[model samples]
Structures are given as C-alpha cells and as structure tokens.
Target: MTEDFVNGAAVQALLDRASGLDAEGGDGRLKAIVRELAEAVMRTIVRHDVSESEFWAAIQYFQEGAAEFGLIVPGVGLEHFMDLLMDARDAEAGRTGGTPRTIEGPLYVAGAPLVEGDVNLSDDPDDTGTLYMSGVIRGPGGEPVEGAILHVWHANSQGWYSHFDPTGEQTPFNNRRRIRIGSDGRYSFHSKMPNGYSVPPGGATDRLMRALGRHGNRPAHVHFFVEAPGYRTLTTQINFGDDPFAADDFAFATREGLLPVPNRQGDAATIVFDFELQKAGASTEEGFSLRARAAV
Candidate 1:
C-alpha cells in the first residue's frame, strides 16, 4: 500500500517510483527517456490541474495523429524544426555555406528513372505552360562538379503526388526523374509548374488543423535531391516567388534565397537557380541525407 499523493513533489515521487526513474537503478536508454517524459507530464498535470479525461483525450489525439505522420510532421512545423537544428549544428562545426537546406516532406520514393542531360519531368500532354529550369552544380569554390545527379519531383497540376494518388498508379513516377550533369556541370528539365497542395481532407491532420483554426496548404514548389562524388548530398525545394501561398506555407519550409522569380519567354517560362555543394569529410558517404545524422 502507498500513501495518497496531494502535492506536486509527492506526485513526481510517485511517478519516479512507478517508472523506475532513478538513473543508477534503471539501465535502459528508452526507459530513462520515458521516465523523464512521465515526470514532466506529472508536473504539468499538477500545475494545470488536468483531469483524467483530458489526459486520456490528449493520448487519443496523438494516436490519431500517428496515422498521418507525413502530414502532421510538416503541418506542425516539426520538419522545419529539424532543419533549424541542423543549421545550428553546421554553424557550430564551421560547416557553413551551401544551398539552404529544407525539409524533405515524407513523400520521396527511391529509384526514379535516370537520364543523361535533361529529362521531361511532366508527361501530361494537357499540362499548362511549360517551365524550363536550368542550373549549374558547383562545389564550395564555385568550380563545376561534373556528373552530379539531380533527382527532381513535384506534385501534379492537381496537387497530387504520383505514387500516392490512386489515379496515378498507372504512371507512377510521373513528374519524377533524375538528370545527371555533364562535363559543363549544367542540368535542365522541362515541367509544368506544380500547384500548391493542401492536407488531405477528412484525415487526422486536417481535423487537427481545422480545430486549431489553421489552413494546411503548402506553396507551389519542386523537390531536389542533389548528389555527387566527394560532396555532401542536398535535399531541398524551391518555392515560386509569385505563388500566392508562398509567404504562408503550412509546412513552414520556405527560406530566403530559395525562392525563384520566373521569366516569361513567349510560350514558356524559365527559372535559373544555381546550387553549391559542400565537400564531404573522409568517411562521409556520397549522397548522405543529413537528416540521418540529425536524429543521432
């Protein structure tokens, strides 16, 4: 039998005992993390007088949130938070100066078809005006990095990704392709500008956003995964400057210097954005996603 706890400190003590929070006694890392979280929750409960029903309701909300991990992580700005943490680490390690890093929203699929030079990113014959994006990939010192591969993908005119949308299963990887830079370090592609995407309706993410009085709409953008030998891999996206939702991205992944202004050329448009890569360390693998290290 245990004494009934009425005070905050007593409540914390009870949690410690129940969760094996004593550092010298509890050995597992996961156990320690859970104990710390439990202690914090206990304090919050005491401070806010949270009722048992409210606590359980919050748990259920998280359970629902888990079903749509992709939408929630970006909608709630966790993906952007991860990028901020990486920027801080890079500053600390004196590893600065490269194209701004952005979040790779959980929609990337590996093994898109590879092509030499440029490949058409949009296959729909009914697509709107063509967008021709051309740029050079250079190293830290502005020298061309030959043979760099740029994996490019984006939503369709209807703001739906290829593999994820049921209607697109026939031509999965539509609007997705990889272009290898030539000796001139230049790569270009033709595609229709992708429309902005909103969180899927009737999902948990949409429900939460509605309850919070927020819109879950991202700006028009294109994703790129740039990789080359002896250079750090980059996963980022570029936002269209003229997009109405550019300043109000739900994912909060937009950054300065990454927005591109379009130049209309008669029937088509062009956007030029150069990418600079950082040299990799001796043991760093080619095309390593920095997010892997941020978790550690």
Candidate 2:
C-alpha cells in the first residue's frame, strides 16, 4: 500500500533475514529451505490474479500450522526422523541386529509396578496367563546385562490400553510393568498379550490423515521400550502374523526381529516373549535401575 514498496517485495524481506544462518555455525539445512520457499511464495502472489487479502490469508494459515506443532509422531514427523537417525547409527555400529523400533504413542506413561520375574497380564493382573516370557538380556558382546531393567506393557482385552480409553475402568498406567533382570541374567513376565487397533481416529493425526484420504488403522502389535545404564533406549513393537501391512505400517514402526512368531496362535491366553539388547555407553560400577534414578 506504500508508494515506494510493492505488495510482495515487503514480505520477501521477512524471509531474507534468514540468509546469514549458515554463517552462524549451525545446521543451515532447514533455514535455507524455508528461505527458498518464502521467495516462491512472493513470486506466486505477484503472478496470480489473487487479491491482496487472499495472499495475507494464506500466510495466516501457515502461521496456524506452525503454532499447532506437537509431539505426536503423526504431527511434526520428528519421531520418524529420530528413528531414521538411530537406525543409521545402529547400522554403522553393527551391534545386535535387535528388535524393530515402533512409535511410543502418546499413551506410554512412566512408573509401573517393580515386580520380580513374571507379570500377570490381566486387568486385575494376578497370574492369569499360563506362559511366562522368560529370557536373558545380553550385551552386544554376548555377555549378560545382569541387573538391567526392562519395561513392558500391552492392551487389555478388547484392545484398549489404559489412560486412553474413557469407557474402560483401567487406571492410568494399566498393563504396564518394570522388571530388572536378575544377577544370573534371567528375566520373566506373564501378561495377556495385546492386539493393535486404529490410532485415535478423531484426534489431530486422524483428521489430517482423513483429509489426505488415508486410513487411520495400525495393525495388531505389541509395544516394548527398554533401557539400562549401558544400553541405548530401545522402543519397538511385535506385530501379529496376519496383517498384510506388517511390512508397510502407516506409523513406519514395523521392523525386522520385532515381529514375534505365532506361538500360541494369537491367543491372549499366553505369550512367552524374550529379547536381548545391544550395549550402549560405558559400563559403570554405579548401579542403575529406573527406580534408583527416581529415588535420587
């Protein structure tokens, strides 16, 4: 609207301020891409027959999208980006070709019962299943990671995880548990295993997917996240055998070694699962369990 300045050139200046980004000694990757796109926006506005207010409205919409940034995997794509970086590291290091990494969905909560060698996978989980998931956790060198802890959880019957189901009576951290491997390198737990369902279909993730005409369903699977003092954090899932999309998870979570075999034939009545982790940082004389860290 000013005499000397036109409609589009003024907006281009807002993005030009990012030109010195690489000189600041940081990753110039994202900033440079943003600047190029900003120039394109200005050119588009100058060429189109669109009104001035319409161009301003487009900017307003992008502002809204940025303001709505979130932690959900389906939102910013950071979760997937982090996974790719981690997998690359794993490949370079040639550690244990371990389990498949999966999304930690917004539902994973900290703190669960610190039990010994076995868990009962019932709502009132008290030894309901017959099979116990027993195994030894070993470092990348095949040495036992004695005293390390493994956290485990799965959905209750009807495929509902706690804290996410308004209709269910389960508590906030419903089928979750934290167990340390014994000095002998053995660990075990009992729980009715889980089956996966759709990602929350009405949330922002699903809304965006529906707008793209994508299905919001995640295939049947089990979630696992494990950590110990000297090992990298592992987040993964074990998918059931029947899903056609097992190789093509919408979450991109399904990985090799995470898909458990059909032992009980998909029955929640029993699951005898076991896993070993690759070593991470320096092994310290200092003891570490999640509970010990929390007590500090």
Candidate 3:
C-alpha cells in the first residue's frame, strides 16, 4: 500500500506557495484556481506513484511538444470537453437549441476578404474537383439573419491549408473567404473539394496519438464562423458524410446536422446546408475569443 502524502501539512504548504496562495498581489480568483489545480496535480502524482524521473520526462515532453499543443488539445479531446461544458452551461441557463457548437481547430487565419452574396474561395488552379456549397443563416424563429458575416476556410485536395502549408505552393488565403449575408440571409461559395487529412507524420501530435493507440485524422470538412448582431457567434464546421473519418474525427468535431453528403456530378459536387443561430445574452457571446491567428 502506497502512503499518500498529498494531503499532508508539508505538501499542502508546498502547493499553497506554488499557487501563490499567500500572495496578495495577483488576482484572487486566479490564485484560488491555481491552488485547486496544484492540489489536484499533487493528488494525481501521489495516486500514480509517479517517479521523479517520470515527472521530469513528462515536463520535458511538454517543453519539446509546445508547438503542437494546439493540435494536442483537440486530439486529446480537451477542446471538445470545453464545447460540452459550454453546452451544459447553456442548457442550465435555458439557452437551448439552434446549432451545436464544436471545437474550433487552431488553423483559422484572420482578415479574410469580405464579399457580398456569393463568392469563389478557390482562386488557385488546382486539379481537385469543384465544390458548390450554399447555405442560409436563420435565427431560432426561422427568420433570416441579415447582416451576418459567414467566414469559411478549408484545406485543398492535397490536405494542405494556406499560410500553413509547408510546400510553399499555396497562395495567401487560398481557400478562405468571408461572405456577408444579404436580406435573404443566403450565402454561397465555390471551391475545390477539400480532402481529409491526418496530423503531420512524425510530429509531436502524431507521435502522441500513436503511443495512445489512436490515429490523428480529420474528415474533409469546411470551417465556418457565423456572426450577426444580437446573436451568439457560431464557430463550427461540417464534415462530409462520405468521408471515412467523418464518424471518427480525431478532433471530435462531427455533430448531428453538420454532416452533409455531397451530391456528385462528374467533376463537380454540391452541398446545401443551413445554419441557425441563438440570440445573444451577454456581450461576450457576440463575437469570438481574441486569439492569435495568422494574418496577411
């Protein structure tokens, strides 16, 4: 039987100091959270009987894999947990049902050119099949949500996104755009059919997933950010129903009403999906979180 020292006085004092519980200069709420987190970590260490070498190795892993943390977060389902938490909170507040929110993967770039009505997202000359996607944005009451901006982005057939592709072959903003909704709240775009992609082979995220006996792969999907006045900003994406990984997305982003089957016709495909928005209650819900993103 392993002796538990996590709750002992000496350990408690160490946790308190580590979390700055005795300091009055920092935020009270933050300090409280830190103390709780530190205690929880201590409990885990004691429960697992983690060796000092193992602990240091884990720290070194994080230090070496810091660049892949964004992917790791989703791959390990932390991002999805956040979505579930938000959903539960909304349900508790009686703010139920429009469209389910999902994890916004860390590949979004800022400052896409805004266009009115319809637009073309695939400006590059690629051999991939053409895709025609159209959608309407509506409120909970089924009324059109005018003045909305629909931001869309996706990877190309080679499973490479602009601004992040290592081949240096993609133009800036290759498959990204922002379409402003007209009075009818309709938005549409034409682009190359995106392909499903796996995490970079041999990278930190891929290595971690392999060690966990899991595969880091996402289905062919289109990302969206729909925002309108008086409505909560929606960050979501739709996976292609035909993709093999649609039901097994590593990012856990697939949701009901978000998987649209593509209608195939020769070298072209068509997808029609509608989106519904919930009314915003707080000002913070009116937009996306301010995070560092690629800009050109």
Candidate 4:
C-alpha cells in the first residue's frame, strides 16, 4: 500500500471535482479562480502546519472584525493593492499624466453639502491651527477643468471622521464637503490640519497587527474624490511631509510626489496640490464589479 500524501496536490484534486460542470453557461473563470485560491490556501495551511484550532480562531477573529472591515482593508494594504492594480492596468493601456490615484478607504458618504470655490470645513471651536489648502483641477495638458467636483473629507485632530463618530451625527457633515471647481479650475478650503489615525485598540484589527508586529496607524492625510465630464474619476490623498508615520503608513498608501510641506502664513498653514486628470478613454466597464464598488 502507498503511504498517504496529505499535501495540497491531493486536497486540490478533491476540490477541483466541484468545478466539473464547465459547460454550464457561465464563463469558467469563477470555478477557475475558486479552485486556484482554494489550492493556494491549502498549500499555505499545510506548509505552515496550521492547526484546526488556529484556523477556527482566525475565523472567529474575522467575524468579530466584520463590522469594521472597511478600516481593516487600508490597514492591511488591500485597498492600496487594488489601487496599484488599477494603476498598472491604466499604464499598460497608455493612461498616464494624472495625479496618482490612491485608496478611498471606507467612510465616504454620498451626500455632502456642495460649496463653491472655497469654504471652511472645520467646525470644532478648539481647532486653532487653520489649514488653507487650494488646488487646480486640469486636464492632461493642464487645460482648466471647470465644474469638476472635488468631494473631500479628512480626520479631525482627534482622528475621528465626521458622521462616523457617534457625536459626529449631530453635525453630520462637518469637515466633509463637495467643492465645485471654479472657472479657472481652482478649489480651496480652510480646515484644521487633520491628525493621523490608528486602529481601534484591543479590537480584531489591533490583535492581528500585534501578532504581525505591525502598528495600525495611518499618517495624517486628507481624502479627495474628483469627478468631471470627460475625465476618469480620481481618488487620492495628500499626506503631511513631517508626520512620523508619513513614510511608514500602515495602509502603505503614501505616494511620492504627494507629500506636501505645509507653509505657515500667519495663523494658517497652507498646502497647495494641483490635480491633473486623464482623459476618459474607452469605458472601463469590463473589469467593473458592482459588489466591489459597494464594498468600498
């Protein structure tokens, strides 16, 4: 009798049986991906000799963290990974010369007050360090992109985002707004410099970070989602150049050419960052998934 070999080859063969109905109308990609991932996971488990107890514990850990899944993606770099994949595809297809796109994280709300060229975003009375940030939205060749919408939001000094915090509901949209680009493609806003963010202490995210010897902190940064006619929507963030975690962001989202040094002008610190957008080419509908959109 042959000795049993419990490596992934045997497990994968067993799993592949479920993919037998290849002619069932659907493209075979679904079963193919499932089989591939299942095999890889089995390999990792066997290679590491993960015990059944450890696997079940991991499952329970994930279940507990499901509510805060949005926060975990950026923390673990999945959000950034997706952005990199999109960027690579765009570059391979000849899409270039746009402000680098970054992760959107999970806190974006659809309806924000639309303001004109410039407005004050911070509502906290104690926020004494004002930030006067402005920028221009232009096309690939620097042509003005009038009427572009800049949906912006950022964490407050205490690292809590408006609307997500319990008290934040009282002033639902504070520190978050949608600004329309002016005729000259200029948009500006005054707010306090947002402080950095960290994972909830003692939560599922924190547990994993601790196990991996990693810290769950993001550098101080602001989020922007720019959309306009004839342009691909741009999602990106700008980080403070001097933040200790600016280069060591847990999300791995910090990008070169995006870190801006704040210049002090009297009471306010100003950072200028202009955005250049790529022209919309063929529709990116092929790789689009509604479920994935809902996840973000």
Task: Count clashes in each candidate, considering only residues at least 3 apart in sequence or on different chains.
Answer: 0, 3, 0, 0
139-205 in candidate 1: lDDT tens per residue? 9999999879998888877888777775754266778888888978888898876788888888888
Of 1 and 4, which scores higher on TM-score? 4
Per-residue CA lDDT of candidate 4, range 31-71, in tens? Answer: 88877777677667777788999999888988989977887
Residue pairs clashing in model 4 are none
**TM-scores, one per candidate:** 0.86, 0.68, 0.96, 0.89
- Pick the lDDT winner: 3
**Candidate 4: deviation at residue 155, Å?**
1.1
* Candidate number with the higher lDDT (3 or 4): 3
For candidate 3, give the lDDT. 0.90
**Model 3 Cα displacement at 164 (Å)?**
0.8
- TM-score for candidate 2, residues paired by index: 0.68
Error of 4 at 181 (Å): 1.3
- Tell me the lDDT of candidate 1: 0.81
Candidate numbers, best TM-score first, in rank order = 3, 4, 1, 2
| Residue 214 displacement in candidate 1 (angstroms) | 1.7
lDDT of 2 by residue, 1-296 (tens): 33223335555566666554435665587778877876666556656756879878756655654422332354445666767787787688674465556566555556776777655544454222333456667666667776677777777655677765667577666677777777776777666655556655566556656766776666666666667676766666666655666765666666666665545633333344556675665554122223211110
Q: Rank the candidates by lDDT, best first.
A: 3, 1, 4, 2
Each model's lDDT: 0.81, 0.60, 0.90, 0.78
